[model samples]
Target: MYHYTAIQWIFFFYFYCFFGWCFESTYVSLKSRKLVNRGFCRGPFLPLYGSGAIMMLVVSMPFQDNLVLVYIAGCIGATVLEYVTGVTMEALFKVRYWDYSKNKFNFQGHICLGSSLAWGGLTILMTEFIHKPIEHLVLSIPDSILTPVTLVLTALIGADFALSFKAALDLRDVLE
Candidate 1:
């Protein structure tokens, strides 16, 4: 198993959240032919991706040596996370942030075979390639600096999440 301090894990999560936001925002903006701030939050972060990355790392620990097992674990783990998050968000907000209702082999418009397969591939790529350099960079940082930065980020993200949650609720009321 990989050993990481709590701060290190938090940093990894935040980093992945930012990265996911960059990717999603760019893709969405390109698709829509306009700039789009994509995510549940107004900030440059996506908690789902952070959570998914962490889950991928944790679930692939035992199967790290085997590519096939790693892929399988990622498929199952990420799919479950996506499904749960989608269901919970829709239930609480009365809106779906994403839907796969038209996709083949979809379940309840929340999860689908294509996404599960993509998650498996992404897990393999992240574990095998993307995370090594990131891990090194994070490890190289001094704890004194990293700790304070993490604390600040935590506060900012907390505030952003609160505001976003309120906005989502307000939108739900409007829709109702």
Candidate 2:
């Protein structure tokens, strides 16, 4: 079991958010043959990824020794989060950021079997491979530096989310 300070957890979340954005943007840009900032926020962050990473960590805590259990837990947890997020975002913005309507075994275009299975694999990869180095790096940082950095990042991301939320609402009005 890994223990982290609140600041450390926050830092991990932000790091994963940026990482997710990079991965997503690159994939999207390659597919479209153009530069595309992929995420709800204008900044290089994806709240869904951050939240999913955190959820994976939390859900896999008890079953860390058993990869199969970890996979199951991740599938259930991530799918629920994805579904709820998709539903809420569509309701608020009048647009679907992701739609699995065409995918086989999708529920309300929000969650799908393939995505859920992939989430399970991602959870195992994250817990077994990705997090160790990140954990070490975060642990090495002194509180004096980490605290102030986290505070600044929190403020910046909060502002970005607020702006993005407002823009989404405005877009919803236009769509309506």
Give Cα distance to truth, residue 36, candidate 1, Å: 0.4
**Model 2 lowest lDDT segment of ten:** 129-138
* Model 1, backbone clash pairs (residues 3+ apart or across chains), number: 0
lDDT of each: 0.96, 0.95
Model 2 lDDT tens row, 1-176: 97989999999999999999999999999999999999999999999999999999999999999999999999999999999999999999999999999999999999999999999999999999998888888899999999999999999999999999999999999999
Q: For each candidate, what TM-score against the reference?
A: 0.98, 0.98
lDDT of 1 by residue, 46-138 (tens): 999899999999999999899999999999999999999999999989999999999999999999999999999999999999999999999
For each of the candidates, the C-alpha root-mean-square deviation to the true structure, in angstroms, is: 0.7, 0.6
Q: Highest lDDT: which candidate?
A: 1
Q: In model 2, state the lDDT of residue 7.
A: 93
lDDT of 1 at 28: 96
Candidate 1 residue pairs that clash: none
